[model samples]
Target chain A: MTVSTALPAVPVTAALPDKKNRRGNRKNSTLATVLLLLGAVYCLFPVLWVLIASTKSSGELFSTFTLAPSTHLFDNIGDLFAYRNGLYWRWMANTALYAGVGAAVSTLVSAMSGFALAKYDFPGKRFVFNVILAGVLVPGVILAIPQYLLLAKVGLTNTYWSVLLPSMISPYGIYLSRIFAAATVPTEVLEAARIDGAGDWRTFGRVVLPMMKSGLVTVFLFQFVAIWNNFMLPYIMLGDDHLYPLTVGLSGLLNQGANQPSMYITVVTGALISIIPLVALFLGLQRYWRVDLGAGAVKA
Target chain B: MTAVTALPTETRTPRTATRRGRRAGAPYSFLAPALILFVAFFAAPIGYAAYLSLRRVKVSGLGLGAGARTEVWAGMSNYARSLTDPDFLPSVYRIGAYGLIVVPTMLGLALLMALLLDAGRTRVGTFSRTAIFLPYAVPAVVGSLLWGFLYLPRVSPFTDVVQMFGVEPPDVLTGSWVLWAVANIAVWGGTGFNMIVIYTALRAIPTDLFEAARLDGASDKQIAWRIKIPIVLPSLIMTFVFSLIATLQVFAEPMTLKPLSNTISSTWTPLMKVYRDAFVRNDIYSAAATSVVIAVATFAVSFGFLKLVGNRAFNQED
Candidate 1:
């Protein structure tokens, strides 16, 4: 009870500190700021390096000082575009289709299943929920090979369905949606909707879906990043280069960097481009990021 | 639907019975899509993997005919092979060591950063928070690539600084140092997200609780250690368990760095070994057994942590 009331009083109490004690707080804050900025620097160093490094030409990438920026960003991007008949752009598009569409459908499915589990009283609800809870703990990448073999048997291995299908059902998404539904969607409102002669599907679409929109967006972002960052699943499943996502395709470029040092620019350049979309998403939707590790059981 | 409507007439009111009948099948219909996908992708694959684990390709009659080799039940032999393989134990040991370094160090840093942010006295809190959390967006492969180049002698800015001072930079991507190098990448990528979780939990603590502590003259450090730590223990523990599971299955970082260094191999970690076995070596039976072992171990560790923590954080909502 105290915790519930305490949540609302947080910002008000934080801003109510008296002026007399502010002097003592200033000293400690300086040290805290320095320590935090140090962490910030460590985290931002690589990102900064990528920004500067992407500007170098292939010859300048190795010859010049590593952090020094050269005026070749446009040329490198142009080269990346022209490489292999614009393969890099195909990878970018493939990643968008995988993460964007995959996350959208997964969020809808999770919303439906989570709404059912939370709002409805059914016979096997506990069993269904427990199975999903256990699925949340299962190391998903462990199933990659088995899924590959099974898909191979069904002749679905080399197709987009192989990646999109497995990516659609996120146990973690369903789990979060359940929590959001129970917390935000009131039983009384649901009963009122039913009393108005609304069917199950209609109530869900009209009432529950709007209430769960923000939470569903959170679910979408989570699954989007999960699918986007995924390397092993698509790495193992997709055999064709044209069908590969950015992570897999870029890693392939890195592997080629071992023999041809010239390819290092492309790998670095590709790595730079791949992260821009994610960094933009992260910065833009910063508020929607609520990570409950217990939901996903594992996130990377 | 029939079952709900056919309940004993004397035992139920007509209105309640009719309502139950209307709502009886709705939940299942809504759950149908998820359940179908789960069975097809989750349960079926697990069951098939278990089936393959206990089977092996049997070769007979000089293996010369059209049906020279056939898959047959091998009982526990595949499990024995996976367990007894020379690569298995070392991979497990390496990952165990890596987890020890990662889980504590990462969580400790996360806790410290969260406490500092919660202190709220600093002007840099919001900037530091966003900057630190930015790496969570970068994929592990990209993070590894960026760090791998930074570890290189020719391309490292740190190397440039060291050479100016007439000293050689320590080899970070070779020998035993490579473990820490890989561990560093994981820490760099993970610390920010965990920090955000712990920080969010900290923000939920009512400031009035700390007002009394401050009146009693508690220092910031003292307040953090005594008050905030206990309050956010559940989030800390949850993050720790999740990190342990993730660290055990470390794949992308090592795989990404393999092109740059010789220290990493096909079996640098258990998951990497599973990938190598199933794909590179074409040993599906052994790979399935190894994967099952890893999966069971992950479940046991995660649930064991939950049990130790009394399972309150997850179930308390219910």
Candidate 2:
């Protein structure tokens, strides 16, 4: 199993003679730059609008100039926080717990299963991998209703475990983990650890995991974002507002906005706050998102 | 290679046999948690859904007593009802239109941006890339909420700009325009991630592969069309499949826009219908049947797509 570990090559176009191609190249570059900047503006428009809009009082939200800044940002946040004795903050905490703990456990599970699949020669390995791959295509809607029913039978519905347990087994994570294990953790190190009288578990814990650290970080981040962004599973499983994630909580708040127009301001403010952690995480860990869909397809 | 080389030296030792035996069992132990979770969460739910889809409650004598409501085999009645229901087909058609609008436009923009970014000719590439990708960090619910407000004429800058031209801005959340409005939210939230995926694939292409085209005096557009696109076709196919799957399950965005817009019904999408049935109306059997139909359709579409594409994108080695 060969892994493509080639570093990105510097573009040959960069070294082209500027004197001759300058006219054509500059024209093309300007067009590309303008197009790209337009795209950037289109994407950033909403986020900027939200930031400016959240600062307005409820009365000003519809009446004021669309882009005008106001002094009611803290007031809106205060109303959001003060709603129903701080239910919004509880949703925030629930989101953190679900994404944080769920991703951590999912990463560990994927790492272990992936290492085993990559390293070990065993009966039914192909069958195991194939089954898990099939799980990837199964729609979540097919599972969510039944999962809720089954969990209801067990009295686990509307609980934290209802959301977290279903999130642990991600076939995509295991698949990526397998690739990372094969690419990063060499067979020699495992053999050396075994020869040095270390147990398999210890060797895996001490050697294999650290070697797959960056890859595992990628896995963790993907799962973290997935759990954080997930609305269907949690929305189906948990009924209690106290246990709702930001997605469910905000949607519910918006539902109430029909009667009370003031809830729209709170909803907007909550939306602004809800996106900060993830956008920050995404920006900080920009380099870790090395997604190559063709990697497995072209090679495997 | 080291394992094979070390095999000759280790085979003579009796301890090596036991070690190999233990190693054979190690993978199963390692895989146990995932397997257990898979069965409990994925396999069990799917099986239970299928089972429940084939059965229904038989309520006798005005449905007054617990004993009168007996569980009985329903066969295909639920499926028959679901397929013939007025709401089900329209939801499917709505999503079909939604997918048609979303998948092409989003992927086209994604491909265009990816090619432009990979061309390395753009100024503010980093800023555009980050900014475009920022929407992905926002959840669908939040993204929809933001866009829902933006669609409101009273609060919309687009409306404000149009009014300056002595023209009225059409209500985006009404009529056929609402479809475009909903589609725009999806396109906005999705284009960045797909762009990054395609961009990553583009970056992986060896520069030498394209240097020859450059030497031949081929234009950037020609090289992008001729060389770069074919190389990333597999990634494109992959993103298409994922995007199609996501498109079929459009719920949150439309659901979020519901309060703001009366145009969106309770059954705006098939998944939404399933949600309405299972939770809202307490019709789990029909919901299960509809979900089964959805699951089967998803499998058929994905598998059929792969097969139609000659299965080149996912030819796993044994």
Supply candidate 1's per-residue lDDT for A9.
Answer: 17
Report the C-alpha lDDT of model 2 over A177-234, residue by residue, as the tens digit. 8877887888877877776766678888999999998889889998999899999899
TM-score of each: 0.92, 0.94
Looking at chain B only, the TM-scores across the models are 0.93, 0.96
Q: How accurate is candidate 1 locally (lDDT)?
A: 0.84
Q: Report the lDDT of model 1 for residue B127.
A: 74
Give the best candidate by lDDT: 2
User: What is the clash tally of candidate 2?
Assistant: 0
Residue pairs in collision within model 1: none
**TM-score (C-alpha) between model 2 and the true structure:** 0.94
Over the true interface, candidate 1 deviates by an RMSD, in Å, of 4.8
What is the C-alpha lDDT profile of model 1 across A1-300, one tens digit per residue?
A: 222222221122333331222223554467888899999999999999988988998888877998899998998888899989999999999999999999999999999999888877778988999899889888889888899999999999989999999999999899888887876788767766666667778989999999998778889998999999998999999999999999889888999999999888888888899999999888777766655444322111
Q: Which 10-residue window in model 2 chain A sums to the lowest lDDT?
A: A2-11
Give candidate 1 misplaced runs (Cα > 4 Å): A1-28, A292-300, B1-19
